[model samples]
Target: MSLPLNEQTVLVTGAGRGLGAAIAAAFAREGASVAVNYRNSGKAAENLASCLGGKASAFGADVRDGEAVAQMVANVKVRLGAPTTIVHNALADFSFNGDARSKLDALTWDEIAAHMETGVKGALNLIQAAAPSMRERGFGRIVLIGTNLFQNPVVPYHDYTAAKAALLSLTRTAAAELGPFGITVNMVSGGLLRTTDASSATPEAVFDLIAGSTPLRRVTTPEEMADAVLFFASPWSRAVTGQNLIVDGGLVFN
Candidate 1:
């Protein structure tokens, strides 16, 4: 279906800045009431909410924490009605500069667990908290954010990539299970986005190499990726589920 988010309530986690912020704005622009969830970037969230006008508001929560996630959902429901769309974009603090020692032997279990906890556990908690309302209405959309790095395995972001891969699996499983309830779970995986906070530290040469290798001969913007996400959240995708849409400018052919 077309993007008619008017009056739809959407919660976007990690939406204080970067790709998350763009996603939130896109939903807002579509007439959706947006809950801009942030862990530490409260000001950024508020600012974005302002730009979205009255249809958007800022929320605080650590998605990895079950209690916090539940509370955030409850608050959003109370303030904006039952959220029909949920976007799991929250991730543990990760660096893209190849600064951390990501070698398997060099990393500790805690490091790996930390990353997976946010992606897997966070997704589970949000779904549990929001799915009931969706089932009651027999309609919902859940989009999980992933990375294209898993396809080529070039960047040795072992922990981050592993976590995202698990998230993709979770997305598929959730879609299968929630299908009868009219809730669709899908994933949008994109390669290094241009000019986001996460990619600001990436080497210019590295980004150039990726852009050159892409069939489109360019890197994608957060806004472009957000467009893909909006499609899943809109009514047009009611029949689509358990799918992964890579928005990496044709870098990986599925």
Candidate 2:
């Protein structure tokens, strides 16, 4: 019972590049109109929208700001119809350089707060803004981008991992509240992606180490993870909700 995405309008946050961009493209390929949301990468977002053509368009907003998120959703509705699918993939500015990360002793509450602002608070803002319309229509899909590091904790990225764990909790809680409205909230977690702006800072040795450790003997790609995200938004997953689907090629089985 797979659902076709033909008439869906999807809004992907932080879609200027990285996994977010890939997710937006995947939805477009499935014939869904896409709103590519970016906080700072305006040029890249616009270029991607142009490349996508059709109903795809670029939008700008800092997801941390509730007002900004509200305005962005409103604009998307006027331009591409209300988004029936929302992907909360926006990340706080971060580099996946384990060597440079602040260890537990040096980690500050401020650093943790930064990640929470984007990962947890940002998802909250988007869901609050979009849930009303979704409830009215009796249909919606909310997918939060997560990290496998929460389970593996290979490098102890304290701030980032903690934030994602909180987001996972929010996903389930949201599912319980929104299920009656025909909305499903779930998470797509991926391990060290081969290369994204965030992961580009990671050393080659790290990538090789993770690849060798995975059953697939390779690092996952943003495009590959995007495909798993599609399953949550499609008709195939209408009965599923609050599940965390890891897309890291067996890196950490949950």
Candidate 3:
């Protein structure tokens, strides 16, 4: 049987601020026990947990580290419960100013590797750590946080976009392998979200440009995109798996 939202424990990585925090808040609003995972911003994470109330708690773990992530998962099981849902929302340090972004000529392998460490390897570590209990329970939900830049590439944030594309591939293959065990893997890709900490660097003109182009005549918000994540974790999407749900206010039709 599928676990109800109130009965499930959800671990949202890199949730100390911005979009990740919004995602964690959405899950908490639905009565799920939320593990707000942060790599460095403990105070922010703690503050969010206190505000969330009802089984929400802060945890620190560099998602890039396998052992640390596993240990964090273990600790979560003790403090909350075995995590049945994972929203891999961690992001490498980045500022969304296309004017300052690296051009292909200046971009290095190390730049690309940084995003991969969190987006790809982090997902692998999380699945390895949390999948056992989920498999035993015959149910799980893995929602990867992705970007619409790969499709739109309006600004061509090469390193960040490449890593998310790789995550999309992993999302499909992982879904096929884990589906028989009742664990669904999917991706929620959002376009340049309005007012995220990273996107705060984006100029006002840029937001206006995007808003004008999108069919909805507005840029997506972190809270709105976060709500799309809840759909994947809920029983309503029981038949859905390996799909990439774009929540960009009709900016990208995928």
What would the TM-score be for candidate 1 when compared with the true structure? 0.97
Ranked by lDDT from best down, the candidates are 3, 2, 1
* Cα lDDT, all candidates: 0.90, 0.95, 0.96
Counting clashing residue pairs in each candidate, in order, gives: 1, 0, 0
lDDT of 2 by residue, 77-162 (tens): 99999989999999999999999999988899999999999999999999999999998888999999999988999989999999
Q: How many backbone clashes does candidate 3 have?
A: 0
Q: Give candidate 1's total backbone clashes.
A: 1
Model 2 misplacement above 4 A: 1-3
Off by over 4 Å in 3: none
Could you tell which candidate, 1 or 3, scores higher by lDDT?
3
Error at 101, model 3, angstroms: 0.4
Candidate 3 lDDT by residue in tens digits, 1-254: 48788889999999999999999999999999999999989999999999999699999999999999999999999999999999999999999999999999999999999999999999999999999999999999999999888989999999999999999999999999999999999999999899898999999999999999999999999999999999999999999999999998998899
Predicted model with the maximum TM-score = 3
- Alpha carbon lDDT of residue 102, candidate 3? 95
**Model 1, which residues run further than 4 Å from truth?**
1-3, 99-101
- Model 3 Cα displacement at 155 (Å)? 0.6
